[model samples]
Target chain A: MRNLADEIERFILRKLAGETNDITILQRNELADELSCAPSQISYVLSTRFTAERGFIVQSRRGSGGFVRIVRVPVQKIVYNKPDNIMDYCSPEDFENIIIKLNSERMITAREAGLIKYFLDVIDDYVNPVEKMRIFRSLLITLENNS
Target chain B: MRNLADEIERFILRKLAGETNDITILQRNELADELSCAPSQISYVLSTRFTAERGFIVQSRRGSGGFVRIVRVPVQKIVYNKPDNIMDYCSPEDFENIIIKLNSERMITAREAGLIKYFLDVIDDYVNPVEKMRIFRSLLITLENNS
Candidate 1:
């Protein structure tokens, strides 16, 4: 039997899959009621599985008309033209995260993502902070141009 | 007034420009005689101006029918799938040469090549030998995939 977290994640993914856009909105209490779990359980699943590193952005609204919004960030949307934004993504971890996110979103194939990650892993130690930023920028630009 | 070397270079370039292919074959003596220069001058221009690093491969066949063949290497031709070949092109100089050659060939725009070179230049000092190899392989694969 699958755990509650897995069930909730699958449920949310199914909702997103059925939608025309890469986004889905839900009422926390209603989702909890339908899943027969606590609202906190839904929050836990959202916070853990649907993260920015995993190519998802979850926005939780709290009020009388409260709802949760989940948006899947496109690979093209992450490309930054500004130098400061480019500098922000200068680490190997950041790059690997982007690759993983791209793979998960089906923007890039698993084989290509795996190969890119393999190279990223090997060169992490030698690539300095500045080089990492430049590489990340170049990669994003390449991807943007190709896309 | 243009020097003999400049004249010879331009003459050869114009000949190449007129041709349908990126390659041109010339009889050294005939070319020298036409340009009012010595055969050695043609040899000098071929050796110095048209080199592999400068994107031209000059093949000189000596005999009764001696001919100098200049072939412009396309950007797609430089992509290597073999591990050994990838390893051979691990140096910063090699990467820069590729960028220059690609730019000269109009395979990649000057701005794109410049951006790539700018990033490549800054990262050279920090990238280790193994890392350089990985980076080169990744870059080539990216270009190949995009192309």
Candidate 2:
């Protein structure tokens, strides 16, 4: 079911989509009033949806003269660095961030991201960490070539 | 290092690629002789590399008349059924299989599959099972619409 968070996300996304520089600034209180919701709701949506993994970085200043800044990360800034502890067993949250990063960078499509998440959710425990790392590294190399 | 197993996997993949029907059969002894490796080595490669998780299936007739049959699963026969215990924490192996199945069906590209695997490997533990399933189901719905 669509909720206030969904609506807020769509509204913000629409605003960003219409911008030429892939960025936008909003007055938080104004946005809240426009959306007919509380300012806290806007904060929640911004924090969750406008995350780095999702290709967005949101900066907001609190109080009467504050504004929110949403910037879509560009491709050139991506370093594609493998984590230092990549050889160890990766936690699910970290894996999710990678998926988000890929989608945000336009390295993969949304559907592809979804497909990846599905696999992550259902992956068997018996597939050991070493095998997982091997697969992950091989996959990154493949994307590096394609992207 | 290029090991016997890697060579054997390549040889079989090459053979499968060249087949018009996406299926192939070979005598284990003949393949071992041709590859100049032990038959046990061939068995290891077949069991590991040519697996359902990688979108492959092997049927072997044991004994003196042994033959290995490799068949690539087709798309139409996919049931897309969510497992009964989907709400529970998913293991790595099961997720790997889902990724493989998606790749095999051509619903996702090899690079995309790899990207998915990377995320699966690194996903954080804090992202609980319920949230994982929610994200996974949404992703599937998106793919269903796109595919």
Tell me the lDDT of model 1 at B92: 66
iRMSD, per candidate, in listed order: 19.8, 18.3
Q: Candidate 1's residue-wise lDDT over B1-147, tens digit each?
A: 869999999999998888776878889999889989889999899899987667776777675456888877755445552465444435667777777776555555554465455545545677667766566667656654654
Candidate 1: residue pairs that collide: none
RMSD of 2: 22.0
lDDT of 2 by residue, B1-147 (tens): 235777788888889889998899998889999988788888888887887755577998988877999986543234245453334556667667776877776655676666656654554443565666555445546555433
Global lDDT scores for all candidate models: 0.69, 0.68
Q: Write the per-residue lDDT of candidate 2 for residues A1-147, one digit (tens) a residue.
A: 569999999998999899986778888888899989998999999889888776676766665456888877753234234355354656678678867876764556666666656655554353666556555555556666744
Model 1 chain A, poorest ten-residue lDDT window? A79-88
Report the C-alpha displacement of residue A39, candidate 2, in angstroms: 56
**Most lDDT-accurate candidate:** 1
Summarize candidate 1's per-residue lDDT along A1-147 as a digit string, tens digits.
336787889899999889888889999999999989899989988988987655678987899999999987655574453243645445566677777766676655554565455545544667766766666656655543432
